[model samples]
Target: MIAIRSSVAQLALLFLAAAGNGALFVIILRLRFVMEQHLKWLEQTYPAGHVSARGEQWYNRPFLVRSLFQFMLFLAAFLSLILLIATAWTHRGEVFGTMPQDPALTYYEEHAARLADGYETLSLETAHPALLKLIDEHFEGETLAILDVGAGTGRDASWFAAHGHRIVAVEPSEAMQTIGKHLHPSPDIEWRLDSLPELADTSASGETFDLIVLSAVWMHVKPDDRQQALETLVSLLKPGGRIYLTLRIGPSEPERGIYRVSEEALNTQLAELSLEAKKLDEQSDLLGRSNIHWVSIGICAATD
Candidate 1:
């Protein structure tokens, strides 16, 4: 859904860029042709060895020099335009910000039913032991407020709600949220249609939480938007609150709009926010794929 829109937008931009460049190239060639025709007329009107009133030869040298300079200037401009396009393309995520639609949301919308069942089958104890341990250690015996971003099917949200926590489950995909609501009809868990790098609705509610969970969700965010996303998440946290993230590490599924997650980049962003993160645990892929893995991280907020 969202992915298709993003692709179309990108294609449109590419087409416009190519068309503009082509038009510019044609105009330059036309100008060159006119200049050549004018020069030819001047040459025929004035003999080769004719000198101007300033005592300079009228034909060969001056014409060649001027033509060479124009050619060089056009060539430089063309090359510079190419370079500029390349740079913009490389940083398109930053330049364009969030896409009109997110591919990951589309994937979830398409696979909501199957994903809900599969997610329900996985045991939380096995799937997220490290996060559970950190939660117990930091927030044990307390009925804390929790924000579960990307809470597809409400699996984690249900678990937290059952454990005496108030939960706000934010899922952007309407399909996923529908299935999630049907599966886990809990009074303690509040569901909202929202998404990351913004979470505009959640932010607008003026709610703060003790714990924010992003389970298998960060990789879907573009690198350029991660900083803003992190800041938004931090803003939703209460003083001394913590954020728990499970980062998927491996080759990305471009079809699913997954990007490679970088721990170093996450750490850098944390530092910029005056926060500190610690590695909670690292584990092989639970789905038994040989090439994939997960790293769990915990970021604690300063209690000033």
Candidate 2:
């Protein structure tokens, strides 16, 4: 089927991209080593009088050989990047830029009041007990830099900020961000317009956080973007910092209109992202949605 082919193509392109980036990084390190070696060779030959007349002539000859070597190194890196771009072009259907805006954004924008009414009280107090326990055990007395992705109406971010943690709340929907700003007017919470797969502004800041929370947000990310979103979140974490994720299970609701996510898939992706799981718990929906289940996972970067 065409769908199956497209999936395969997308996966292949992802692999190519990973390999190309790795190759480029290795080549750059090698390039640096080559430069050091060339400089050392020049010093030994020109100043140390270690060469015969013919050898000195060769050593002092035009810098064409070094230039050629440098050119070849750059050419290899260029070719690998070109290959990555070509692979991306061939699988453009799943490209993040080409995907449509998440329907959940529209849903939340249209029904912000309904969502707020139903979930406003849901914060660290009402969170899954296991996750709360983990938070208490690990971050007992430390003030943290917290990142709340898809921080709907600033419910959780408000709690963290109130508890003396600095917070960055990211929400792409203007409606939700506006409501959050109005509802939770806290100087500790910095509001930013950003979203997953790439948190451009956050990434640009070059600051990592001590805690990152994604409460019922990952499902909005498409399957192709899941890995990248995880990677981005992990990159934003300081070493030994934790990420608490709450995944809503079961079918996608017509109102939410987001992709379905599985616990198995999440664990697999977390392993691929090199995150170490501290705890994982499945619980019935606390909001009295009978049709819904939740998976709460606590994970962190491995520390030596």
Candidate of highest lDDT: 1
Tens digits of lDDT, candidate 1, 159-243 = 9988899999999888999998998999999999888899999999999999999999999998889999999999999987889
Clashing pairs in 1: none
Error of 1 at 24 (Å): 52
Supply the TM-score for candidate 1. 0.67
Which residue pairs in candidate 2 have backbone atoms (N, alpha carbon, C) closer than 3 angstroms, thus clashing? none
For residue 61, what is the lDDT in candidate 2?
46
| lDDT (Cα, tens digit) per residue for candidate 2, span 1-304 | 3333555566566566556656756786687689768867887878775332332466554355445555665566566567667766744544534756356776786778878877786666767576567778888988999999998899888888888999999998778888999999999999999988899999989989988899888888878999998999988989878888888887876456578888788888888866676446788888877988888888876451
Q: Compute each candidate's TM-score over C-alphas.
A: 0.67, 0.65
Q: Where does the lowest 10-residue lDDT sum fall in candidate 1?
A: 49-58
- Report the alpha-carbon TM-score of model 2 versus the true structure: 0.65
